[model samples]
Target: MSPSDVSEADAANELMRLAKTIAKHNKLYHAEDTPEIADAEYDALVRRNNELEEAFPHLVREDSPNKLVGAAVAASPLSKVAHEQRMMSLDNGFSDEDIAEWLARVRRFLNLPEGEPVAVTAEDKIDGLSCSLRYERGALVLAATRGDGQIGEDVTANVRMIADIPQALSGETPDVFEIRGEVYMAKSDFDGLNARLMEEGKAEAVAKNVAFDPAKIRQFANPRNAAAGSLRQKDAKITAKRPLKFWAHGWGVASSVPGETAFDVMATIADWGLPLSPLVKRFETLEQMLDHYRHIETERADLPYDIDGVVYKVDRLDWQQRLGFVAKAPRWALAHKFPAEQAQTTLESIDIQVGRTGKLTPVGRLKPVTVGGVVVSNVTLHNRDEIERLGVRPGDRVLVQRAGDVIPQVAENLTRDEEREPYIFPDHCPKCNSEAVAEEGEVDVRCTGGLICPAQRFQRLAHFASRPALDIDGLGEKSIAEFIEAGFLESPADIFRLHQHRDAILARDGWQDKSVDNLLAAVETKRAANAARMLFGLGIRHIGAVSARDLMKKVTRLEEIGVLAEAIEAERSGIEKLPGEEEKKYRQRIDAAVSEVIAIDGVGAAVGHSLADFFHEPHNREVWKDLLKEVKPPDYIVETRDSAVAGKTVVFTGKLETMSRDEAKAQAEALGAKASGSVSAKTDLLVAGPGAGSKMKKAAELGIEVIDEAAWADIVKAAG
Candidate 1:
């Protein structure tokens, strides 16, 4: 989503959602060793979060992903180790321009002049597990995983077996040092390990005299996962059997002086017999570093281990310390990541699914293909327009891109020119067979079924009990869905009858006597609710709280609105627009029919038509009548202060230059006058502005007191 399209409130809500999503992925990847999405998809989430935060900085939440590093080690099975130094994550950049901008920012922070030679070290960022090995007097004493960059899981026994991780240092070493690096498995070793696992599972099943099921064999998704799963074992013997390798990237919690430059420290670590990336090099210019990144990317495919990007760090440790960090990443270092993973797969089929709000979304099924170490079989088409834009159909070869989005998109339809029947979007709801129509100037097609549509009923009920509607406490979205699934709730009326199912609800899981009683008590409190709130709770198309209250103020009772709806329906039907009817004549005919409904301020022909159509629907009418039987809404009333215009029916027409139509009505209300939308026998005064037209003429015909925008402003001034 673009930043311009999102408001502060929407950005705040999205940031909250992104924080939870990123945290979930972090736990799956770091703590549990099971990742749901590819690294690119996860990165996309973080990118979106960063974009929103940049756009609306004030709305950045406390729990934002930017403030977090890795998953907490609380969920791990192994013992915990408190680290002396926190392991920081590096900020990521995906393009040459991004790297250049990063370098510019570093120079700005250091107050370095333009074109200054800022030396930096670059290395391939390996996709593997992060481990911290602590050495006391040249001997490996403890090894721990980087969990939340703080306390970590103690894997000292597990790392002791890996030959690549030396148990004792061979060169001059510090009295106390904690070296941080990656535990990785090579691509070839990962393949062989997966094969061996499947074969061993088959052999064990044969030994047990059971039929071997290959589907039940669990294999790692990629090399990174293989290394993580193999290393994080409770039994070190299992870790010893697995081919795991370790390489030092940097050091943490060190006592003695090692090197002033990052590259020099890496040289000392290599001298201490720790594995290091041979491709690591130092560059003096941004251009040289970016060029080195490109070269490393070219060699990425042929590399022994999986590398997603190139990490660049300031050569001088003093500059790194001075630059410090922001949120969770160091300002002096950045990882120039690779682009999104793309793979071509066949578009098997397309399916339309209706969301809670009745939005019909199209999802495309794909032939299982691996992209960025994850098997992708489904992609969201978003809407009908996207499908038409792609011209995608079953059997078409489509290039799916896992470009940092949770759901992969159809990047290109390779067989778009192939002779095939074009996919047709359904005009009816799949759940209820109701006519699905897209609103004017809208892209999404929605079902008009409202409460009758099973897909929308859950949300409808939840909204009905929401604060804006009946304000019934204890009936949240989750509880409402649980009630509906348990057959305890189907409509808003069923909420009042939940007392009958109190025992039934108590019998089910998670429902106690006190909670059930509290819910029932809250529902019982709405028996004598406000007429406008009750009407708004019905989830009608055009009727809102203000419009509902306006209609109720004129009609008095809830039943009268039904009668008025029938009246408008009958009047409009008799004067229905004929074929070849002129626009003016048709407008006059409709205006005459819905004159009574339009007379109410804040409501117009839209509300009249919506009410008529809603009352005409058999299901809606039945539900409305059923809800009324359980609920008795009071007549809407306003206690107004005494004023000159008090108790007078005032009608406003045409363009109100000084104030909005609603503002005019609100001023009239403040003066104790009843603001109306039409000039009629009951209208005592008419406030006319430019292009008043028919209303002004009608007021003259009815002999009502007429005034301009200036005169209305005087009346409000006099009231003050």
Candidate 2:
């Protein structure tokens, strides 16, 4: 009633709202891969809350979200795990200038000479939930999510669902070792999922609102949200359905090991069956590190998953220890985030596309939005289920935002009219008018058009010409698509016949003499590709680069493999009798055998099944046979066993006073030994250099033999 009373009421209401806002933001930014507001907006809310809390100390609640790192784990059937070393969060830098300042601080703390080179390793700061995994005697013992940097919830069961993580180490097992990483959703999987949601009739208002979609209602907001939500699920089955992936980005604790450098540590982790981040790069100078950051930003859109920023850390463990911690985060590392890649756009139209796999994907044709310097007109709608859920129809007003700032997506419907009819998904293929069918146990409605459909054929041809496949560099996706549209290229086999169109292509607009020559050169270069790469270029369903490699290892050439796969399929009466063991075991054996020969650790059954199925398809086999006439896989033999190192587990830790860590690991691998980073009892030998940390102590405790740089040289010389 009085002025003072009113002020008190306003303060209380503001404090309550701040707490709620912070909680929601934490869930969005940390748990969910999506953040509704920009970082500045979230920071403003937090800053206001801090000022108010400082003014009203008594008003500070015990459960304030500001003091927390992330939300609680999901209700998945995962066993609780407690981290031996707490998984602490890193402080962030909003810009390149911010990163430079952080580096300046690091230099000041170390009293380093001006412009002195500081070895830095830059890696993708994956947008996902933080987690730690523990291994004992080579066996996975625990998996936990980073809670408050002090304690974490256990999710071992859910973690086991990820095929990238090894249940057992490769070589000598450690007494105790912990590897830390981020769990995330692959971009492809996320796209597929959103598409499925659109078809299910549970879409929301904003792309942020789409978090409420029924398919993901129980899941988190974005990939990061999905990851955290999946990890925290009380039921393992729930987490399994989310298709979470792990990328080892860092380490927390290891009882014992030898290796002096961060690179050595990562090499060891990779040997232990952890999928390390692909973006990790070593730099000799701060300038090079900055360059890498820029490169990462440029390549962000091309990456298969989301990265909020680039994480820079001292390459050597000794340097990291010398740097130590500043307040809460490590002084040895910094997170450099790129500018936000989100924008508001009007929904001009919505279109449906049929994929090479026949799955229908919904794409939003937006009113040309500019985000982070890129002009985006189309955003992925995910699936028909998502359309129904968002209640989005043609002509509805909408807001579009890019997930990870690369994949443009409809964030949500900004405004809609009840008079507009809901966008109905076509029951037939748009390209061929074939009957579209949704398979049992599948989320997408697929067209049975196969290679006959124009869209599928074009996509397949484009994929076959991709850089990693046949490597027809000049045959860009746009060029391939255009050629297909112009009736120049029709199928994967047609790419070989492109010589016939040289004059025609040269006559076309923008087709200069140099361009034509480049295209021809690219095609010629692909004629003698390695078997694995050729198989990948085929663009078979579920047959990815990894599977293609696996298929190659089974048979020396494409012809033999095609015949073998056909014979195996012909001998079968049904899917049950297709090959070898039960469908699952048969696929697992193929994976294990292929992985063993290629030395590609962690290749799983899913990849193997996809390869086998592809090879068994009559149409696919016929296409391959025709293509093989023009292109031949190189006749090179991959040695599966040459040295004891081939299967031996070797752990490297501490500083290598002699050879560089990378050189050491390479030498070990050459000798058939699996060179690892951390030290454990299973570690055949701990290569200790000066300044070895806890890993050295653990190796000593475990009675694992410890060797210096000289001793390692002697061992290598003796083996040779």
Separately for all candidates shown, the number of backbone clashes (residues 3 or more apart, or on different chains) is 0, 60
lDDT of 1 by residue, 1-720 (tens): 699886543454466457756876787777777655556667778989999888876555545688778887744468988888888787888778889899887886677766678899999999889999999999999999998888788999999989999989987899998889999998888888989999999899989999999889988777877888888889999999999998999988889759999999889999999999989999998778978998998998798888889999999998887676666788788998887778999999989887655779888898999775556788878688888999999999999886322346788999999999999999999999999998543467889877778888987888788766888888888888888988888888899999988889899888898988888898888998888888877867656555677788888888788898888888778785656648556755675567554576445565676788789889888998898889887777755566779989899998877556755775775576777766789899999989889989988998889999999888888877
What are the TM-scores, per candidate, against the unseen true structure?
0.58, 0.44
Off by over 4 Å in 1: 1-6, 350-365, 370-393, 402-409, 416-720
lDDT value, residue 526 of candidate 1: 95
TM-score of 1: 0.58
* Candidate 1, run of 10 with poorest lDDT: 7-16
Highest-lDDT candidate: 1
| Native-structure RMSD, model 1 | 16.5
| Top TM-score prediction, candidate number | 1
- Model 1's alpha-carbon lDDT is 0.81
Evaluate all candidate structures by whole-model CA lDDT and list the values in order.
0.81, 0.68
